[model samples]
Target: MRADIVVGLQWGDEGKGKVVDYLASLYNAVVRFNGGPNAGHTVIANNTSFTFHHIPSGALRGTKLFIAPGMLVNPEILNEEILSLKQLVSSFYLKIDSRTSLITPADVVLDKKIEELKGASSIGTTLRGIGPAYSSKALRISPRVVDVLNESFDFSIYKKLYNVEFESELWLKNAKKTLKDYASDVREELLEILSKQGNVLFESAQGTLLDPIYGTYPYVTSSNTTASYAFVSSGIPYKYSGKVIGVLKAYSTRVGKGPMPTEMSEDLAMVIREGGKEYGATTGRARRIGWLDIPALKYATEINGTDEIFITKLDVLSGIKELKVAVSYNIDGKEVENFSPLENIESAKAVYQNLDPIPKLYASDISYIIKNGWRAAPVQMRKYVSFIEESLRTKISYASLGAERGMTVKVE
Candidate 1:
């Protein structure tokens, strides 16, 4: 059968992990297509919270986990994650594609050094060696997972290039121990699953706005994060691509440095930040909070060809007297309804509309929505959802009310 893709429509942290975890049980396999340890997907299942950087979010659901070649594997971090997962779950099926590149200590050092050299212009990366690891792969000098298993694998080039003392022996030993059994070319198995009509769910790391190509230029992540890349990175043919599910937060939040046109005032940001616990799952840095940008959201959905939308963290916006949504941007005195990557987004002025806010949703309100569907939600909440759906010209199939898996309601 075809594989459905779940991707973040806004910035990287759109609660994609929770959505993937919520739907994992219906899939035969869950695949991580791109990114590395820099991407943190936090999933709360059975009251136990799991922050997965390398492993797929579906691990808690016991779905088959596949790390595709487009991913960069930091062996140490991955090993630690798997070990931790073992204590929470009974067992998990995992496979790392042999072609997946390894992130070495040298890469981490280089990442920090490069960001340091940038100084004021720093991209504010998670400092997980994601960029350097991807660069090594592009230069054809990175050691793949298969190379780590080879006894004769040489790391002299990496040491020479990065000018860092890499413990080749220790790194190789750990890599072998961690990946020997799990590393392989998984394309054939994926093909077999598709041939057998097995359902597969492709999980995307980062978000459309963080994609290297379509994103905000040099400020973007090292790899492609859009839904279309799911097929290219997962080694699955585009013909088998199914629904493109785009995940977005009720209000926008971004981590690190970037042009956020609709960024809220510091006072309002602090309120929402505390309410939503707006912090990076990987870096633990306070995220920049902002009002929802409809222009940007529409741009993301169009580029990814998103089939359905999933609005998350709706409860986070509760209790505010009024809510603001950016309906367009005033770029250089011109009102623009559409977002263009070519324009200077940082300087664009957001034109917002203040709408009536939903009163604080009690546990009972969330429970009612969960049991009675989206129509049962508060009038203001429904109005907010309807505005987003109308603005994007797409259906919102799901909306998450809380952090737990059961806190979600299907939109009808």
Candidate 2:
């Protein structure tokens, strides 16, 4: 069995962790390929909620987890996450790639300093040192996990270079002690799994719209948040990568500073936010809500080569009288159905089409809808689903009615 990739199609916080947790039982291992503590993947199972920063969401179910070299490791945060999980799920192992880069205390200090310098124009970073750590990796000056494990390495060099105050010796000692049990070369284990035809799940952080290369510039994250990075990030072959599942919300929401063409009125946004509990799992920042942007969703599906789609939080819109979908973008007075990352996206306006709201749906109702098409679905909801299928030309394989692991309905 090849690896199945799960990614977020919209901005971050697309309920990826919940979907991953639901699907994790089908895979032998869940591998985290990119991003860092900046990502907040929240999962709910057995009425217990978990907000994962560095650990894979599958770990809550005792699935074997691997952190790849493409990811940035913040040892302190990871240690805290691990310790917290141990209180609930007892039997779990986290395998960390030796080549993974470390996010030093200096990097954290530099991150806050950079954000402080930006002031009001800051990109709304989580200030978790992810950007600085990635910058260090790109410059080939970052210390790897293996380097941190070495007895001779001096982490004080970072404190001196960045002019940040950190007890490097003490922090390093603690981190070293914490990570000693998890550090290893995970590539060999992944290879063995593939060789034995065992299924793997490569869980991605953030979303396609936050991807550095494909997302809106200057507002994107430091790492590639697409399924295309699975091979390189996991040190696995392209042949082992199977289906790519792109997870999207019923509507759009963004956390940081960037142009949101379909942004809604504050009162309506607040209602949706409260309905969906739209807050960053990592930062706890309230998200900016908007109507579903079809053009952006289509563009993301095309870029990620999404094989199947998972739509989440459909229940959040149950009580709304009407729903507005962004059918296209009017940029410089020209209407376009296709969307490209823009340099001045703030000037773009969304062309919306309103539809009637669906009656309230339960988790089982959604399961029936998925198993049988939209034959029995509400007329307005049918139109919404049809529009999505036609726009992306992909199958809607899963629908999530709530945040719990069992709240998902499978279409395939």
- Per-residue C-alpha lDDT of model 1 across residues 264-346, encoded as one tens digit per residue: 88999999999898888899999999999999999999998999999999999989877999999999899999887789788
Write candidate 2's Cα lDDT for 73-158 as tens digits: 89989888888988998679789998999898889889999999999888988989999999988877788888878855665566
* C-alpha lDDT of all candidate models, in order: 0.91, 0.86
Instruction: Give the residue spans of candidate 1 off by over 4 A.
Output: none
Instruction: List the pairs of residues colliding in candidate 2.
Output: none
Give the number of the best model, judged by lDDT.
1
Error of 2 at 163 (Å): 1.2
Worst 10 residues of 2 by lDDT: 369-378
Deviation (Å) of 262 in candidate 2: 0.4
Q: Which parts of model 2 are misplaced by more than 4 Å? A: 361-377
